[model samples]
Target chain A: MFVDFLYELRERGVKVGPQEALTLSQALGKGLHETTLDGFYRVARALCVHREEDLDAFDRAFAHHFRGVPDDALKIAEEVLQWLLDPRSRRELTDEEREILEKLDLEEVRKRLRERLAEQNERHDRGNRWVGTGGTSPHGRGGTHPSGIRVGEGETGGRGAMAISARRRFRDLRSDVTLDTRQIEVALRRLRAYVREGAQDELDLPGTIDATARSAGELEIKLRAPRRSNLRVLLLLDVGGSMDPHSEVCERLFSAAKRATHFKELRTLYFHNCVYGRVYENGSLTRGPRIVDLLRECDRSWKLIVVGDALMAPWELTASNSPWSWTEEDRASGIAWLVALTGHFERSIWLNPEPEAAWYGTAEVIRQVFPMFRLTLDGLTAGIQHLLRGGERSR
Target chain B: MDFARFRGTDAYLTSPELESAVNCALALERPLLVRGEPGTGKTQLAEALARALGLSLIHWPVKSTTKAQDGLYVYDTVQRLYDSRFGDGDVRDIRRYIKLGPLGEAFAARDRRVVLIDEVDKADLEFPNDLLHELDRMRFRVAETGDEVVARERPVVIITSNAEKELPDAFLRRCVFHYIEFPDRELMARIVRVHHPDLGNQLLDQTLGAFYQLRDVQGLRKRPSTSELIDWIAVLRRAGVESVELDDSLPFLGALLKREQDLLAFAEAMHRGRRPRA
Candidate 1:
């Protein structure tokens, strides 16, 4: 059994050998005899694998060797195939019905869904109440609902559901498509503050040669490290919603910032739509500490870089009692907070993902806060230069 | 094989999954692959496991330009050429120029040893793939000496990555994987207690709350890690400040938050009356 598994791994380009096979056999006889599949997987992986790249191959091979032919019905591909075959059966919900459904509160929809499920007798079709297909039901697939717990079907269209009720592992809506970090790295290079601040341990080859010659070949070597950049950058990246299209570029920027050793200090934060009373560390920002707390604790000397499209509903930037806020009490507008941030940081700029021409027509609050620059290499260079010059620009 | 024996160690904490993974890796003579964010103790786990298992650790820190072969052996061809041309020294024996690297040393050790490949992600993409065969067989061919150096006793290998680059899937398959998640407030408190036993609960609690608050800052690229926390506490202890006041710890913020931006933002927050509770 182990030999067949080893054969499978080798076929998958795992590079397993006799010694590894021998060890595996011994392991199976001892520690792995009564272990669970996960334990077996761990042991087998350890014995046969050496590189992380081969993990997927090994997994495929192991599944093939142990589990036999994979059942297509267990996969989403099967469901997709079925959906394609029965394409004519799917019914589209009317616009008026969708509008009415959209007005239903999420809690009320959930309650109605539960009641419908309890009363349901059989598989339903084009029904309004029971959990089934092609209906105004908020429970099943091939149907439309303003807000729903879409059970047992893949998403066909955006209109199929307004809100997801059940916990789900949604496809990473942020494309995560990548751009070459090298270009971003080059752009970020301009943002350095070239000032020597650290220990001089770097060897000066030319100086060492000259000094050695000057000292009558006494072997005296001179050391000089490149002046460390004292530039401290605080980047607040906008994520989610409209920013989804720009994820790849944003990621490239994030990666470049993280990789750049020139900056003495670089920090990053995430926000969605607009900066409210808080900012978050994670992209989803479902559960993270408030950004305002950290802002209050900031050093004030750090250069602030706010990266976002600056195209959001005016309410997000100016309304004290916006929908985004969890509290009933009126809070200060996002513009107020941003204004405070600009005042706090001596040198700061907003790097707009959108073009320079677009900013004039975008939200007025965005224009009111800081000098907005396009998110290009040239724009970055210009922004950094503005920061280096160190004065408040006309807002 | 008995992980239970090392449970009481104050230097490091091991989760059940990690304990199992380590044991499995050891039993199967496979390298363990650890992935985590920076400062999550991926490298420390290797050191701790080595100490716990009573094995001599052989460390091979990787750089971006590092090759897989550099971990096994490095042939001093230039030195040999220099010796042969200029000196009367014997350069015919190639073994003299063949310096065994960390991996080679681990393999050559007669007793069981632990090999730590730290920051494997820093290496070029090919590095992990190139080591696939050598690591699987626990042997490598020294081209200079025309000898195959095999492990006398299979050395336990622990490979850590910061996930800087997506590692080759083949390399990932050969190892038991573990991700050390960022320590929560309670877990961090426990970790702090382990490091500083004499610290008062009130002081530790206050410090942890502030640390979490600081870490929660949205824009911080690098938050204060455990080691930094330890350093901060040590600095505080050295300064002999007993009351654990936020104002007193201002000067030592450099130890906790290295980024100038983080330091500035922290100062702004402190002045803005949103400071952590005393």
Candidate 2:
């Protein structure tokens, strides 16, 4: 089996001639039988590993070529195949492969191999140049150039340089490619392992019949992705003034929230430190489109993360929009909108960039409203984590 | 150091055993299953391969909801059911609207591609077995029909598991395996330099020293990942600061640790890094 394995190497372009195979066979005869798999592997590997790379490829090829050989012998073949496989096996390469590997580089090596094969043919050919074509040599070609200058093709002597150049070029031109990493990240994100369907919920037939007595057997309970109670945000962002020191942190938290809020729905409304009857998205500002849009869109499906240090005048939390909005609807009792916005979210948390101690001085009204909205002081990371963990209604 | 001049780039890439695993994936050749620690770049290996190899990366993010078809191709459950019941074969070409799931896209890819089956451990036991048939044969059956489409060649298959859970033995048999480890400090620093070259050496030293100190402490829920270090620098840049100050640096904590408790614990440790005498 081992001898046959060596023969396979030659066929695969390993240059393992019969003599070397015999020597390996004799080495095996002496005392290699009881050797560990590792031991045999080491011995074979030393002789076989060339190129200092692609050992895995060589091992794979070796394994495939020697499929069911005994373990020790298989290891030996693996070593040999690694060392020998590179120069042989493949007859042709794709155009991209050739281009990337630079086809011209192999011109030297291929030329040398061809020259060597031709010389072997010639040295033996001259001695037996007799032919069957009405007394003529096979190289005759109707008596053209006496020595068949076809061998005189290129003007290089050793052709060793040519073959070497070609091989080097081909090796050098190998495309610099690796597997796409994003695909893996994406795969991990959307990974679904099973077809999980919830058992059907029993229907309340009597109630349905009462609502539509004439219709009979009206609405039914169904299986779905499940009503995922999600998140919504009425962000009264302290966009300017005293908020400048913490603006960077706020922006980053916003970024994280946008990305991390994938599981449930997230709708955001922006305010300048205080709530008004109106909320703004882009440039448009109308009272009806306030937190109510978020409320309707969310349908009690979201938790609001209002990001700002609730640190303005008491009146700012009350009737007036301290930062000033011209609309009469907004200016009148902005505090009503604040209370309404809090109700709009299933649960709302105040992510104050300001330290806990600093939040105490905020409008007296805010202090009253603080515990009501489930407000708390958390830095950027904590704040985000709190939202992701699902901001709840009080401890 | 100069990435452009490494004339032997492929040689170096192959020098690492994992790189070979990556190359096999590129040849559309075979599946590679990597088992490693939580952050050992096992999963990231696939993403990197996709980018480096220039193959269209179709990702089938695996989870509990993950199924073989989910991994192979996206199936619109609501729409498919709706059309099947109401339209009665009269709907538009569903095959066109079939929404090729990441795994299915890889198999269907006319060009060479990489399909990442991330966190196979998160999936059910049957998920791996279900995948085995397609993986072994390099082909999958479309749900609508019994037609089996083999890949133009195999996609460089990469399946990463955080090792929090174990995958099935059947899945293991169908793949070429490698276990990636977190790069050592030296490698970590190298990675840092690769990703964020703008940081000054002095600031880099302080940040790295802080990391070393943090890891040396006890009972912390998490340690910073290479990715987090980049985020920290980005924060510093965004803040218009050339150096990372000991104060106001807590926000970068999220990038490093997974849990909120870990961040608080890490921040507490940072105080000790500064006030050694205390």
Candidate 3:
């Protein structure tokens, strides 16, 4: 039966081989059950991949392999043999072959093919998404129905429990947890109302013409796209010892902030324990030309998201370190530089995952200088909501 | 979300990116090249693919000294001798025990498995050039059986590299590439929750913050990975350090940072920056 299945897949131009058949049989034994098509799908996936372009051929092989079975093949076959056996597809068969099946009173053969053909037609009309249906499924959003759909769930009566448990868990799987802003889809909708510059409703051309007749053969009008932040973002991450705990969260925030806004200038710099406003060279954080270059290049419109817990030891921000010890400036200028940067960014906000209560006693000096932009940490939910809302306000 | 569906005790064991890469592999039929820093689960991709797909896991941790044959087949002299001395049995049975090396076994697998050619960068400059055909053809030759094993289509293949230097253009052309960056804070928190279920929320948050601060420093040769921080927290928890104190933090530094030079660099960083308690 397996041999016949392979032969059938080959006849349909699937390029099935010995190793692929092994995978098919394995997925089948693992339980191809009621959802026969879905079972073959898992098998097809495991055994058939060779190149990015060969996927379509693999799917065709799977469909043809399970299209139909002859009565003789099922007589002495194993239970899984049911899967190996399938209805012979008249789609790939010759006219002569169809004539034979017709003689056997199989009227549904052509009807099934016609139905598949009609479904194929429907797909092209519906944006051509299914591979065999002659469409694309980028992001895995489109595909033809498979033989089995629940094999991954397991092979028993626990389907309800299995589904319930999976649904109960995995409900909120955030790929990035950095900035806690709304996803692009959701955030875009909120900002759409503010997108006032979308090329003015086809220029009241007729209105201008109508006005020309009344006025001195001329028209005076004004138009605008409204203020938009082609957006510029500067990301400053606190790396090294102090940020160890919030590293992952910071990364997620960084990822989200990168994706969320359309910044005109985006310069992400990594600073060690604290941002002395110095750059690193030869593994040593030093005040260098690049540091000045970054500062000199910046404009006030850029939105800055500093992702750190901001729970510093207080002295790092308040203490007076030597100016020569850094570069270009003394400890006084370093503190002034930070204060200057904070004042420069008009559309900036800081996102600290640490709670407000935690920061209350630790780094009070930081807030004393730049209290406006701190990520007001009320709690996870409220904090994220505020970040998203603030991002919306900025754009 | 259902980590139970994940493959192992580590690597793909609890990672979302790994899951996406594998699913992408199955659906697209594309060989994936995953890159990241060391211990960020580059090699674990193949291991997870093997477990998730339910097949033999064939691994070849490519060393700088690896030869192409190192991954294909190896003769089990002792087993062959045993078979020769005992039942004088079928040579075919002995051939089965002479098991295929990870990459070779993946291709020669009786059932389709996920083959991980780990640390491809460690392999010689000629490695990818040599693999171009087998990877493209999805087939290999088995000497014991005198058979050519073609893709009856059982294995999902994932290759990983650290990109210590650079790979040839030929390699980049043959596979789909993805960079597995370090996790962000939220994902890191989830990971901490998953791995160190015993850690308190407040302590966990502080430890995560500490790690990020460490990463900010430009001195360390290697930054502490998400897993390492979790390990550090576990050590601290075990050592009875109730808070993120500097003395407690210093002892656990070994788990967080690698390279003695990097550690020295980290200590120097501690000189003027904020201390753990501060």
Which is the leading candidate under DockQ?
1
Would candidate 3 be rated incorrect, acceptable, medium or high by CAPRI criteria? incorrect
- For residues B1-278, could you state the per-residue lDDT of candidate 2 as single tens digits? 11111111321222244543343233224476776556556656666666666666766678876787776665454464455446666445667446767766777778877777888867654577787787878777777655566788467777777654445544553455565555666766666676677667887776776666555656676676656666777776677665544442744655666787776676676676679756
Q: Each model's number of backbone clashes?
A: 39, 52, 74
Off by over 4 Å in 1: A1-395, B1-8, B86-89, B245-251, B271-278
- Which runs of model 3 end up more than 4 angstroms from their true locations? A1-395, B1-20, B75-99, B143-146, B245-249, B274-278
DockQ (CA atoms), all models: 0.12, 0.01, 0.01
Writing each residue's lDDT as its tens digit, candidate 3 over A274-358 gives 5665644322443344444666777665555565556666566556673323544545533464676677766444555565566
Docking class of 2: incorrect
Better candidate by lDDT, 1 or 2: 1
Candidate 1, B66: how far from true, in Å?
A: 1.6
For candidate 3, write residues B1-278 as lDDT tens digits: 21123334443444543444444455445467777777666665566566655667766678876877667667664455445446466745756555566666667656766777887867655677788777778777877667676767646778887765346645554455556667888878877887787788888878888888888777777888866887788898889877674432466788888789887777777765656547
RMSD of 1: 17.7
- How far out, in Å, is residue A194 in model 2? 16
Lowest-sum lDDT 10-residue window in model 3 chain A: A133-142
lDDT of 2 by residue, A278-360 (tens): 56663133333544455565654355556676777766666455555565555655567667766665445566665455657
- Candidate 3 reaches a DockQ of 0.01
Candidate 1 lDDT over residue span A307-361, tens digit each: 8998887667777766655544326677776887888888889887766667753
Which scores higher on DockQ, 1 or 2? 1
